[model samples]
Target: MGMFERTASVFDDAMVLDEEYQPDKIRERDEELEQYRQALQPIIDNRPLSNIFVYGKTGTGKTVATRYMIDHLQEDAEHYDDVALSITWVGCENLSSSYQVAVALVNELRSSDHQISTTGHSQQAVFNMLYTELDKIGGTVLIVLDEIDNIGSDDDILYGLPRARANGYIEDARPLVIGISNDFQFKENLSPKVRDTLCEAEILFPPYDATELNSILYPRAEKAFYDDVLADDVVPLCSAFAAQDTGSARQALRLLYLAGKRVADNGETNVTGDHVRGAKEELHQSKVIEGMQKLTTQGHAVLLTLASHTANSETPVRTRDLYDRYKTVTEKIDADTIVERRVRAHLSDLTMLGLVTVHERNEGLNAGRYHEYELSVQLDSVLEVLSEEQRFDDIVEIVKQQVHGMDRT
Candidate 1:
């Protein structure tokens, strides 16, 4: 075969590892799908439909499962004249409020050439427009709002859609809402009225365990890679690492994809355990950077303190030490300084993000206990990611010099 004749010596189709690729079959989520089916059956029957609230951590098959079940539902509903199912799928991540969501929906349903501007209307007016558009669809409309927690505290869409028919806002359509959220506390933040309606049938999708992730990746490995492209134990190793990291099937697939790509690019015939190791580290660094991109000024500052210490020989650094370094960091960056107490809270947030590990130490019960924290990730990864933020560039440079100077000392 010519050197460049084939796109890959390994992958038959790499899309099987893609995040957007829907598997022909969903693995390890049979029970969750069954429960989702029960929650959805009423809509197929043209009965009063229950609004759904689904909660799960990232990459746990919540979105995929929802899409899979609804695909089957929509396909089945085609046979019935009474069941006119119109599915409106919205990702609420970028559309942060009820107003924005309503306008987006209105535009989605409107004639393409006649779409209205997204702003300049009152929230109620935008909602009225949404109701008008839904009435036009005139069916059992299942609105799947993924990342529904993006609305923060103002979940007017949830509160309004469930009651749209009864309140006479939407005359012809019976609207059912399916809200999928990754944020665990989002439902708790909803007002009781919104919560009761939106969470009428709640489904929680748990993270996948090691065995489950292995099961998920095995078939994809078969489809994506040529026969025997992956060396022995590579799939299991990917599964184990992902299970330990986040128990996310998506993460496992990504590791496989990255490793396969590495082997292909390097003209290697086999994807090995070493390739998986490198891929996992690359994925970890990317995830940490992505997570850091979401942090606030204070979050970045507190993390910098930990990274700065880790750059030096110090680790399992005390909270007081973190606060002290954080104070210096905030001053250098010209960012608004947060109090030590608030820095403690930011430390907790950083800990939750898995950027750092925390340990509680008791002062032998004679004095009050305090906490210690260390960077859970590599200091190099932290500095690289934070360097992307312009305000933090100066600080990262300072830390780079600090580490270099420490080395010389």
Candidate 2:
């Protein structure tokens, strides 16, 4: 009794549910793993390493599984004396072009004092330096470039790295390039010579199903919360919602983690369906907020117009009607007046951004075909986002008044 203790906690280890947590075993990826293993077999055999390209949607265990297998490859290769393996893993997202990537890899291999600047070298000079660094290692190198498509159309590295030894660029080292991407079309757009070498063995990871997501989340939940903290229905609800969204295992885990946090913060036991729903709303709000931050001035105006219509009615708003609202909002906010055609285009862009939903309506005879737009997010949330921008605050109040009737169809 001398020492006071805190209240009972809900979490055992929250980081287990984090995005960066690499599980010792990957669930629902057995066949993918086997394919991955075969692709990397050349490296283990001390033969010429084959280039690999892995394609998968986000949260499909591509990065984690690759890291897992490569880690094992590094560990197992230690027993063999002939195989001199060096791994350079580059996240191409941070490197914009082939030149930057070359400079980055070259710097990555050097000691701190010997590093080069991010600029000040021609692309060829940087390539030369990178090859020099690779030759110094004088071994078989596996270059794992994650999100390789982030380099945009600059495909020099794609063409250069695979043929570095044959082209007399790297005299001693043999480089094996592995490209990973979430965008499938990026590979299709590659130059043929670049494509043939980098696309040696392509592995596609499909999105997870509800059952698979549930299977993936259970182990994480077991490790994240106390046995009695989570209700029976929590996992199923999270899995179903994520499966509905994109069949993403990461989304399911994040939902569970967020819901658990919500319950614990409220000092409640047994995370219920209410908590799960609350978590979903919070996540959706945050996602919309992030997406909104990236919109242009006209984009925001178009979105606000659609949101105004959606909040006021039970029915969807037509393209022409939505354009009128957009013009009104732009005028009130003292913004530029865009044409109806531009406004219609903005609606399509908004739909693509997932900020708005659209449906094609075939009108009987004279009305012809038209599209309708609706806000995909809650009205109050979108309004809140708009209010944060001082320029829109005044007009946003008027828009809110227009939405308060809620009787229009």
Candidate 3:
């Protein structure tokens, strides 16, 4: 057979399992959908729109549910003459501040040929341009900002846009800001003024439970695979594993897709629980490597220290001990060493990234308390990623020697 020739496979429509594929209807989200509909009811009633804040963890269907509701809202509004609904959607993942977000909004609202440059405009100038665009649309407008937490604490746009009418920024357009974020703390950290104006309607989307995930995966699996191609336990195993890890529907679907792909690659007809387990490991290693690759040089040094100790079975090592090893690694690389306090901060970052786990210990008032850290990932995985960087070759070798010496002793 030619290299690209078709072979025996299981997938009938693999794209159904993709992240961008929106199911005809969102599953197991009636409660959230109802709440969302209620939040958007004012627009249908010809009343002023309420600013809404949506909170949920990643893969909890926040974006998908929002799109679904907006679609329905737009269709329903057409029956009424008064409601001239216009929608603008912007992903804020790469936009870091209110200024950048405002600039992006202007570009999104403008025609391709009329779009403004991202720079060279003052903040007030950008706001004026955004207001002008909104006025031109001149109706009940829904501005959807996904991953809004990326704008961080600079929330001038969040505060300004929602209150545009009251602040006399615009007259013809009634704009409602709907901000979606995966970080729980983003809402809490907003300025009080911004909180009051932007979060007029707050909706929370909880992560999916195992049963919910099972419901979501079954249909996608049926569409993605041929008849009797998935073992009975395959979907259940994927759902259970994802629920235990993050309760993410996206993860569950990905697990199912990977399992089926593995079976198809092996020239087999059935995707088994074993294939699911193997796929889970592959996803985990991929996640670890991706996370590690995004780290800074100092972050890598701190992680390498933890990984080396982990390989020697010496973890749950104290902060001071880890700091000593971290300093040694930095010195060998001819990089300036940061203070121990800063080292602790890097460890905290690693902990947040799920690469390291930390525990607090107290041995009485005199001894006070301190934290101990260890690699939460497989040592082999960490070593594999670090080995790819030429700067870490000498450090990786030292780590191997330490492990070998410990084994001999």
The candidate that achieves the highest lDDT relative to the unseen native structure = 3
lDDT of 3 by residue, 1-409 (tens): 6779777789999999999998988999998899899999999998867899999999999999999999999999999998899999999999999999999999999999998888899999999999999999989889999999998899999988888888888999999999999999998888898888788888998989999999999988999899888889999999999999999999999999899889988988888999999999999888878999889888888888888788778889999888888888888877789999889899999999889898999988777799999888877778878888888999898887877877898
lDDT per prediction?
A: 0.87, 0.86, 0.90
Model 1, TM vs. native? 0.81
Query: What would the per-residue lDDT of candidate 1 be over residues 164-204, giving only the tens digit for each residue?
Result: 89998888998888999999999889999987777889888
Superposed model 2: Cα runs more than 4 Å off:
1-8, 305-328, 351-377, 397-409
What are the root-mean-square deviations of the candidates from the true structure over C-alphas? 4.2, 3.7, 3.9
Give the TM-scores of the predictions, in the order they appear: 0.81, 0.87, 0.85
Clashing pairs in 3: none
| Model 2 C-alpha lDDT versus the unseen true structure | 0.86
Better of 2 and 3 by TM-score: 2
- Whose lDDT is higher: candidate 1's or candidate 2's? 1
Residue lDDT tens for model 2, 306-328: 76776667449888887777777
The regions of model 1 sitting more than 4 angstroms off are 1-7, 291-409
